[model samples]
Target: MHISRRQLIEGSLCGAAAIALKGYAQPSRWQPGTVRHLLPAVSHDRLLLKASFGRPLAAPPTLRAGPRAATGVRLDSSAEFFSFDLAGLEPEHTYELVLEDAAGAPLCDPWPITMFPGPDAAPDRFRLLVYTCAGGHPATVNSDTDSPYFVSIANRRKMLLTGLSYEPDAMIAVGDHVYWDLRSPVGSVMLGNAPEARRLVGAFTRNLPVPGTDNERKLKRVVTPQISDLYGTDFRSTPVYFVQDDHDYFENDEATEEMVTFPPDDFMLRLARATQRLYYPEFLPDANRPAGLPSSGAADRPAGVSESFGTLRFGRLLEIMMYDCRRYMTLTGPVGGFVPETVEEWLMQRMAAEQTRHVVNLPSTPVGWSAGKWGEWYPDLLQPNGELGTARPKYLWQPGWNRQHNRLLQAASAMSGVPLFLSGDLHALGEGRIMRYGDLDFRGNPVVTVLTGPISSGPRAWPSAWRGTPPRTPTGIELEAGLDPLEKNGFSIIDFTEDRVEGQMFNWKMGEPVENLDNLQPFHRFTAARGA
Candidate 1:
């Protein structure tokens, strides 16, 4: 066991040579058991620290914290995470992150992160940059090397740089952080095995179909290759609050039962639980947790965890009610899916008691897309006569689900007196006002729903259903498409002050501002008075 340095070196060389001959060699630059790099260690004094790649190394490394020169010095553990406590820090403070390997070798070029204080600290003033659906196949191999799949340290750096430049308090990742393994017509590669440390595997892959390609044979070969190079790198970072969408759990328009065609059996349900553990940092209240069906006489049943859906309070001014529509929603069918009775009651109570000036409903899917024209009938759901029969309509823009959730939104807008609906699903951005009819619940009080498309995926046009919709202006409900430029990939920002709330959209690649107008197509802006 106590081998000499020379002997160790010689042995490593012989092993490497043998592997190279077998075409299974690692890069020469990396040696077996030699530490590659170290992440910035988490410290007690630090408000927040982000981990890019997966699990921290065995032995924790040292890092500098606090201000320069007279900054406080501390040691950090590699196991747990660091926090950014809003209470302790002031608004608009810039901090630098420096990472190194065990031997003190620098890992990445140094980067700076700025902390923005919330509206509480600045009197009804806060800013947030919203981004969703990024990270697919890269333009070239060079981009791949520079920025790998989910945990693209380079792309994150760019996002942070742009976010800081605009000085946002928080960033909202709408959903679809990673796509599960699915074949695509595009040449985008799929990730290999999921990381063992995190128990989740193959949850995120590149599945977006490549545009404008006619040859299907060539596309299949190129897209089928396993991307073993970028697996196991931890990409989930920042304080992201997300819900499970179809792509996040399975292929587009795929139902839970249809997912059984794939391996691992109940892929969608299993991945749903696994994804919650791997990515989310928060937990749901015990009362609302999911309980799997009871075991029968012959077999043991699978256990279940509560779905992630609840309200988050940001001071007294903002209340975010996040919904897990996927969990309760039914697949495309005739019998409408019902929100678990418990969830509906809870939502109703929250809306009735909400005292916050702004109540934001973050649903994974939008409320407006109707089925007749905007919805597509999957091959499996078609009949022999080529006519489509109604399947179980669980939140697939069926009239029932829409009416239910819309009523909840209407109540929040009327009771709390302030409502803004933030949604993301279709890779296109749009804004519109909700129309009300009879009572204040769903009739008179109107709510504004703004849809922000995918951050890095293909940009799509708003479905025809969203267009030609009328605005219930007196009730303050309207619908319009936000900044969604086909040629650009980007996100949206909301800046709030005591008097007004400023909504802006930005292009992540160019790091420029976009106007909130139809001419810009997908990108546009509109401001609502703080108390409106």
Candidate 2:
């Protein structure tokens, strides 16, 4: 059961040789599963593509336009993964991407990719599929009783594929993409006490080389099953933007008397970075976004890969500014926030600019609701008696986070159009119209906040089941509940246009027939009209 990378390769070669000897056609190294994943993100004239293989490629693969046979440059790569940055592409044009060998033989099947509209070009409509908490393997956590993922990975995949079938223009996956929590107290308890989980997930090594060392192999073993193996090439054609949350760093966001597990340690940061480099495409550069922000344009990162913040611009119609709340979170008392001061300024400026008809603030942490968790913007605390209270200060909750949250909400409410925010990490699907946050009132133009539903969390993982109660409106905020938070495996299809933004939420519960999932339909619907 414990197979080394070299041994796995040797075994694969042996099987391939046997097939060749029996007069069967040999398989291409670029076949699906061998070339583990291909994830691409696009702009009007630029495309960034990332692909990883089961084994290292003997030579760099070429990306070509299937119709015109145009070539794309292969960037410098590491180990088993490579990236491609295709520039000067035509906007709103569809190009068939063909992966080929050195000799020009086709490697994998041709995949068609379309470029987005330019910043100045306004489209009539654009649709997006948004979801969160999509990463987890049932075997890697506690057993059936304690903090278990009640559903199987295959079931989760079906739910995702169902969402994909809706044919949205692009996809936004909010955080908790991977759930291999390691160092935090809860992580330590879940991983240390679960021997079977260790056998299934492998171990995390510290202070080791990133790409070439044995530790890299161990890291691959742990993430492959959760990411590549789970989603495969299902998202290859969709321009997918991934946002990272606390669990993606391999630790739950928690502060304890023993240790503070955020602002990720050097090892945790390296692990998360390496995972992004190997499996997924980072946010491509945007002209309107500053390149000097936290991890954006950092020297250590691959060229054009932005780590902390990104943007999704569909001409002048819609723009989604996505930021990772965990990476740059600071703990300094009243000034500390989930995002840095620079990022906060950038967000406010972007929203105030009113550059697009529909502006969405997408963060990894949800607002307008709380289960009294430590990482939330509100200071509400989950007491021992399973009641939520704000009389006591949270373990390490920063007041600045709430201050920044209110500031953003105020800015959004004052915008010309309806203020909208889509977020995740609470593992539920719901929406709230924030009428007031603290003393700032938005009754005239209530800031609309939404939990975009989770993709992989099972029954045991719901906040109500684990925290002993469901999420509720926090103490300092007054909200009109449009849709109460419901724990299920689901996603949202949001349609953006010049007039209004409409969304349909779809979900399916466990203990039900899996076949029925294929016929799933939107269970809830809501629309936010433009203007007051």
Candidate 3:
């Protein structure tokens, strides 16, 4: 049965109204929803976990990993969430953690989490699960129907479970973890855009408020289904590194007469930060990482963890320098880039260090593919001829963005390890070898880039559906295409070893039965050997 957009909105509003009435009667600080999600981040000797509860606990819960126990610290910012920071754990050792209430009854099922290998400990192999665009409520912008664009929430959970079954050491979710575009002038099926939609769906207030206030309540209503409801306790075992893109800031990376949403304003930043604090764990601090990086403050956190830039070190084998490109992007023409100069210097320094046997560049925005969006590195515009062309003016795109892009690629190519970059935001699954960048030639050691597939985009959300064009290789860069960008819903499982990195891309298109995903296999695979 086909459901109209208006019908969907009305039904959702009805449910919201019922929830509001129940909350008013209960008068609880936090509404008791069935949304207990756990996100963990780990280092060689420590573990940081952020978990939410369905209801306010009678007292603080405790997490027991073998004989070591850590009491949950209630975050003052969120009512039903707790933080557990445990240090001095044995590296590369699996700890089965049991969460119990103050009364010693099990709160949730026990989960097994493993710490990364120690800094000097050389691990034989490590596996990473990576994907992007896994944000959207099946009932909001899209119905719970199967499409080439999006799948049902149950199916998305199944895919996550399948990936988790692979037992990856860590997971990297590149961007678009949520899809609530609040202030776009363009009419979108995504909730919270237009006035009627905002009113019908719900709106987060303009003012930032303390936790347990009406503002947090409104914010939770908008993000919970997109996040906790979708990933409830499933990733309890795996360490997840979440990088933010435009939509995570509650807007699209769009530039029109009415809005230029990139380089987020203060409210957006605060809202984004607050959402992360409530829903996920921030990137754990690294000793060598600069303390002054964006959001690397001790405020409300145990220590200074970088909310924007992060480093994932798996012993002496792999180091992934992941940076959020949307938070600190500037618009100063030739002087502006996706990240600030300070961050660029840090990234370049890390690339030069080569402390690990393998170094992969993980950024929110992809390097090889472009849908001609305004926020890309290249100044290519989507021409009326349905092609991307640099001859046309791309509004608000800076020359410095491309310059930074070239510099980063060149640095990666110069490194001793295979120049492999895994990125998101392209809404596709593809791989290409970037052999040249304008005047720069890297034929001797070409840089390889991959688009880790989208997790939750439905038919209407694809670039071809919304922007009127499929992603293409940007002009002026010669790319030897391995898997030309294919719009689908899937992810990549990458295995890293001392001498090589291997990847398998698994995806499913429109009209496919969701049940098929239970036994999905890789559609494409590739391997990059270590540098001599």
Candidate 4:
């Protein structure tokens, strides 16, 4: 049953006739099809959701979260996006929420979905498929006639489908999910003044998608297809959690100058909120978080706990803390890194709680790697040796950032159970353990960090510190050698039981099974105990 690429062409883009092949073109917005797409599904506690995209006929559409049927809520935007949120659904249970146009025609292709497991149920084992930095600009930017490689795009779609084949309980997208390096605004147009800030903000957003704006339509054209191609039917079945990193939110690792000059209340603030509101799922605002969408409007900004950061508890086996590395201190101008103060406090509190047995922190940035002042780190930290225009960047080795990071290490050490941090951002796959910083006496909790990444992004330059024969860590961390730098284009499949966890990194060859990663090929594996 081998099919050639020529046989899979969808439309004239390849100068080929329409795919008229029923299933291939059946779920497209532009192609003559019955359905357009099944929007990326999201989970909130026990609730599971899915939506459809197509022409909105006169009567409002209806949906069923399995048997719980309700009228669809149309999200007003460039095009109609109807959603169904199935409340009170049992955790760890499966459902197929169907959407029907007024004529009773189902909008989604048949798919089975499961809700996030609840607190009361403790599954003996759970699996996760993790990766990050799969980003590229709009595909249309390529030639109207010539065929573009689309290497990253094709690889990303491949990665997701393969990850799903393992039946991972959830998919953790560790940020850089969407790159904002498209067309950024010029800095000269911005100033601290409200008017100038507004003008600059407008310029920045000219190419971005803002809900309810005409640009949204253009955005859906590019974005919707990407979602459909990458996630396919699995996104509807699994609980996929997205971590919004620098690229997903704004310009590549964007930190606006106006934001620094005027703080969070500036025009850049508005843009941040607007983009978030339109694109992502709803997040319950933490009370410790300030009363703003993007910025706090105050100098004493809270930690990175918002819709972007929260907790996911899985039947007492794991206390999962969501991490948002970019938003914590990126907007304030200072190159300071680490989770916000409030967020740290909350996570520590959770980790030390009586019921907390295993603690898991999922961050966008890799958990290891310290900086030596010469400026290779993105935001140069205060260094003994100066570099990067600003010599006082607050990198991990610097006192401010170091203290915050050390505090996290301290909490992890003091915890009675294993503290595991999983992350992306860096385009390399590796694992390490953070020892208590000697400076922080008695901070000796064993903290483990496993990094998976760059499903379709660049093969990053491995950090000099991590490239040693045995792999190195700045003073406070030690490398876990069995699996270090699975540098090929791949993703990590992690399976966890109550006492131990095993991970395998897999790469796919071109023309491999669309539904599988061909795991029999070159792969890297690692295992660790719950706590040592």
Weakest 10 consecutive residues of candidate 1 by summed lDDT: 293-302
Per-candidate TM equals 0.55, 0.90, 0.90, 0.72
- Per-residue accuracy of model 2 over 74-187 as CA lDDT, tens digit each: 322444667776777888877778887667776666666778889999799998889998887566545656555545667677677667666778888998878777777766
Q: How accurate locally is residue 12 in candidate 2, as Cα lDDT from 0 to 100?
A: 28
User: Top model by lDDT, which number?
Assistant: 3
Those runs of model 2 whose alpha carbons end farther than 4 Å from true positions after fitting are 1-34, 66-79, 144-150, 191-193, 300-302
lDDT of 4 by residue, 1-532 (tens): 2222222222111111112112132334223134444433333334423344556555556766666776755554533555454555666666655667777876544445565556656768777878876654334222234332123454466466556556676677777654433323321221111242233223334544455665455445434544444443435546656676655544443233332221223333334444343333433333333445343332322122244675555666765677776565523223344566666667677767736356777766555643332111233332344322235543222244445566676777677666677877655677766554455543355577777756754322223322222222444444444566444456788877888777877664334454343233326777767545
Clashing pairs in 3: 148-510, 149-458, 149-459, 150-458
RMSD of every prediction: 14.3, 7.7, 8.9, 8.7
Q: Could you give candidate 3's per-residue lDDT for residues 1-532 as a string of tens digits?
A: 2333223222222232223222222222222233378888999888888888888776888888878889998864445788888877888777877888889988865656778878888988888999998887554634344333346666677677667666677888998888777776552444566344466456667775636567677677777877887777666667889899888998888887778887898878877887888778888878767889766885777677888898899889989989898988888888888888888998898889999999889989999789998889888888878789977788778898988998999999999889999998988999989998789898888899999998887777788997889899888889998899999989999999999989999897556875577577788999888767
Which lDDT value does model 2 have at 308? 74
- Candidate 1, position 148, lDDT: 35
Position 397, candidate 1: lDDT: 39
Error of 3 at 252 (Å): 0.3
What tens digits encode model 1's per-residue C-alpha lDDT throughout 1-532? 1223223222322233323222244545323222222112111122333232234444443333243312111112333222111123333444544454446555444434343334344336556666556533332132334333332323433333344335444455666655533432221133222232113222232232222222122222222121111111111112234465545543444333323221123444444443333223232222222232111111211112234464444444665666655555543344343354566666676667665556577776655432222222111122244333335232233445545655666566666354677766655555555554334334344566666545554312122222222111122223343332223345667766655556766443323432121122224677766443
Which residue pairs in model 2 clash with each other? none
Candidate-wise lDDT, in order: 0.40, 0.78, 0.79, 0.50
* Rank by lDDT (best first): 3, 2, 4, 1
